[model samples]
Target: MFISFEGIDGSGKSTQARMLADALREAGHDVVLTREPGGSPGAEEIRRLVLEGDPDRWSAETEILLFTAARRDHLERVIEPALASGKVVICDRFADSTRMYQGLSRGDLRAVVDQLHSLMIKREPDLTILIDIDPATGLSRAKGRQGTEERFEDFGLGLQEKMRAGFLALSKEFAPRFRVIDGARDPQRVAQDVLETVQAELPG
Candidate 1:
């Protein structure tokens, strides 16, 4: 099984992704936990360029290219091999992120983002868990994190609100493969909800 957890920054998707990977491993399943923009060596290098530095470090179009390149490296080096070996790959984020982030940043270039994805990284997770949370709370939690990857968060609350909307809309558009979970609850509670959802989808 391949799974990806997604949400606005601070939606607890990464935490839940890790929890799910641990839970699955505890159940004797072969699982590989990884993340986007930097899952493999090459992509990690790209991650630094895109994630750190000034917010205006790259133009919207250039940023999209960088993200797509990183994703291609991640898929080739990390995601695909694990899946081929029959391990459950739980990724923190994937193409949906690029779709949503770039869509919001450059509305006119949304189509270009889609084209690049189709040409380079034409894959999707077997299941996607969308951690739905309000932008206010999400931003507050993100602000508490200590990291140089704050470029996206630096977009501020308004941008986050728009991202939240975009993500929710994506969940609907891809409802067949998406499981939306409320992320505003306690961490344990939210993790449990995610576990149950994933467990139900697991084969006997």
Candidate 2:
């Protein structure tokens, strides 16, 4: 199975992704926990370029290219091999992030983003768990982890609000493969809910 966990910065999707991978492993399943923008070595180099620079270092179009390049490398090098080995791939973020970040909510290039995705990478996760949370709360949590990859969080609360709405809309648009989970609760509670939801879908 291939799963992707997505949400705004500090929504605890990363934590849940890790927890889910660990849980699956404990159940004797072969699992590979990975993340977008840097899942493979080549993608990691690209990740540094897009994530570490100044906020205005790249134009909307340029940023989309960088993200797509990184994603393609990740899928080809890391994700495909693990999935071929029958390992459950749990990724912290995936293409939906590019669709949200570069596709109008954060940037102004929705059409270009869609075109690039279709022309290059056109795959979706089997299941996507969106850890939904309020923008203010998520921003506060993100503030505590500011570092080199702070560009997205630096987008401010207003943009985050818009991104939240965009993600919610995406969940509806991709309802067959999307699972929206409340992320405002405690981490353990959120993890429990995430595990249960994912478990129900797993083949026993």
Candidate 3:
């Protein structure tokens, strides 16, 4: 199975992704836990370029290209191989992130993002878990970590709010494979919900 987690910077999707991978592995599922912008070695290099530096380092259009390039490398080198070998691939973030961050944050470049995805990537997770939360709380949580990848977090609460709405909209648009989960609860509680949701969809 292929799965991707999506949400604003501090929505705990990454934590949930890790929890899911670990849980599945414990159950004897072969799993690959990864993240976008930096999954494979080549993509990891691209990750630093786009994720660090100033928030204004790259415009939306420029970011779209950079992210796509990274994603292509990741898909080719990591995601596809794991999936083909029957391992569950749990990814921290995926193209939907690009759709919101680079597509909506700076302008309406969603079409551009979609076009590139269809042309280059042409793959979507069998399921997507969107951990939805309030922008203020999400940003607070994100900033609390104080990691170096603060480029998006530094965009302020305004961008986080917009990204939250955008992700919710994407869930509806991709309803069949999208699962929306409330992420405002305690981490363990949230992981329980995530695990249940994923379990239901696991192959019988």
Candidate 4:
């Protein structure tokens, strides 16, 4: 199973992704936990360029292409091999993130989506879990965490709101493959929701 978790910063996707992988392992399944833009070494370097660099350095189109490049590396090096081994691959984020962050915020949805589709014909996740949260609250949570702000994380609330809306719109368009979870809830509750969703989606 290939599952990707999506959400704004501070939405606890990383935490829950780990938790889900642990649970799956306990259930006797082989699992690989990873994150986008930085799963493999080359991709990690690309991640720093894309996320930590000056926001003004890259145009929206450039940002989208860079992300897709990182994803291509990640898929070739990590995601595909693990899936071929019959392991569950739980990724922190995937193509949906680019659609939300660049497409919605930058006002070039079709171009970004088309480019991504061209690069990654097998890019779609089997199950996508979008953790929904208010941008203000989510930002506050992010502030409490220990890390320098990435370019995308530094985007304003308006952009994050638009990104959230974009995720919702995509979820509506792909109901069978998307699961939108409430991130405002307690972590355990949110994890439970994700667990249920994954259980329903994964084959026996």
Candidate 5:
């Protein structure tokens, strides 16, 4: 199965992705754990350009192009091959993020994102686990990380609020494969829920 985790920054999606991968590995499953924008070599280079530097470094349209470029490289080099080999692929973030961060952050150009996605990258994960959390808390946690990838976080609370709403809307928009999980609880509790949800989806 192909699984992708989505959420605001510091929503614990990354940690949960890692935990799920580890759990699946422990259960004797062949898993390929990866993350977008930095999964493949080419994507990694693009990740730096898009994620680091100033928030205004690239406009939403420009960011859409850059992110799509990175995603295409990631899909070609990492995701597709692993799935073809029957290994479970778990990605930290995917195209939905592009749909939110760039598509809605500045304006309502979801059509552009969808159009480009249909044209360039036509793949979607079998399951998308959204870690739902409050914007204020998520931002606080994200800021605590103090990482170089603060370009998005630098947008501050207002942007985070918008992102939270956008992601929730996405969860509804893609209801079938999207699982909304509360991320405010303890990590282990959240991981257990995530694992169970995923296990239910895993092919026999």
Candidate 6:
């Protein structure tokens, strides 16, 4: 099973992802926990460039290509083999993030991202969990943690709201495969909700 988690910055994706993996392991399932934009060595290098680099240097097209490149490396090195071995793969983020960030809400760059995703991740996730939160609240959580923001994280409330809408639209388009969770709750509660959802989807 390949399960991907999606959310805005500071939406508790990483925390929930780890918690999910731990719960699965405790339940006697083999699992691999990883994340997008930097899952493997090559992808990590690209991640640094894309996330921490000069915002002025990369155009919208360039940004899309870079994300695709990282995704390709991640798929080749991490996601595929684990799934082939019958292990549950829980990822922190995936292609949906690129679509939300660059395609729908940010650059109007869906065409380029769609083409790449079609060629690359032909098989979508068995399940996608979207942790939905208001932009202002999410950003505040993120700012509290890092005390500094990356380029994408710096995108103001308007863009973040649009991104949330994008995720909702995607959830509608993919019905049963998409699960949207309210992220305004406590972290433990959110994680518990994710656990229940995954258990319901993947029965023992």
Q: Give the TM-score of candidate 1.
A: 0.97
Q: lDDT of each prediction vs. the true structure?
A: 0.91, 0.89, 0.94, 0.84, 0.95, 0.86
Q: Which ten residues in a row have the lowest lDDT in candidate 1?
A: 101-110
Candidate 4 lDDT trough over 10 residues, lowest sum: 114-123
Candidate 5 accuracy as TM-score: 0.99
Give the runs in model 6 whose Cα sits over 4 Å from its true position: 147-149
The alpha-carbon root-mean-square deviation between model 2 and the true structure, to one decimal in Å, is: 1.1
> In candidate 2, residue 78 scores what lDDT?
87
lDDT of 4 by residue, 1-204 (tens): 999999888888888999899888888889999998789999999988877757677888878888888888999999999999999999999988887777778776756566676757456899999899998888778867757546766776777777777888989987888888998989999988888889888898
Per residue, candidate 2 scores C-alpha lDDT tens digits across 36-112 of 88999999998898888677888778889999999899988889899898889999999899889888665577888
In the order shown, the candidates' Cα RMSDs to the true structure are 0.9, 1.1, 0.7, 1.4, 0.6, 1.5
How do all the candidates rank in terms of lDDT, highest first?
5, 3, 1, 2, 6, 4
Error of 3 at 12 (Å): 0.6
Work out the TM-score per prediction: 0.97, 0.96, 0.98, 0.94, 0.99, 0.94
Between the candidate structures 1 and 4, which one is better when assessed by TM-score? 1
lDDT of 5 by residue, 17-75 (tens): 99999999999999999997779999999999998999899889999999999999999
Worst 10-residue stretch by lDDT in candidate 3?
50-59
lDDT for predicted candidate 6 compared with the true structure: 0.86
Distance from true position, residue 189, model 6, in Å?
1.4
Candidate 5's error at 35, in angstroms? 0.7
Scored against the true structure, residue 105 in model 4 reaches a CA lDDT of 81
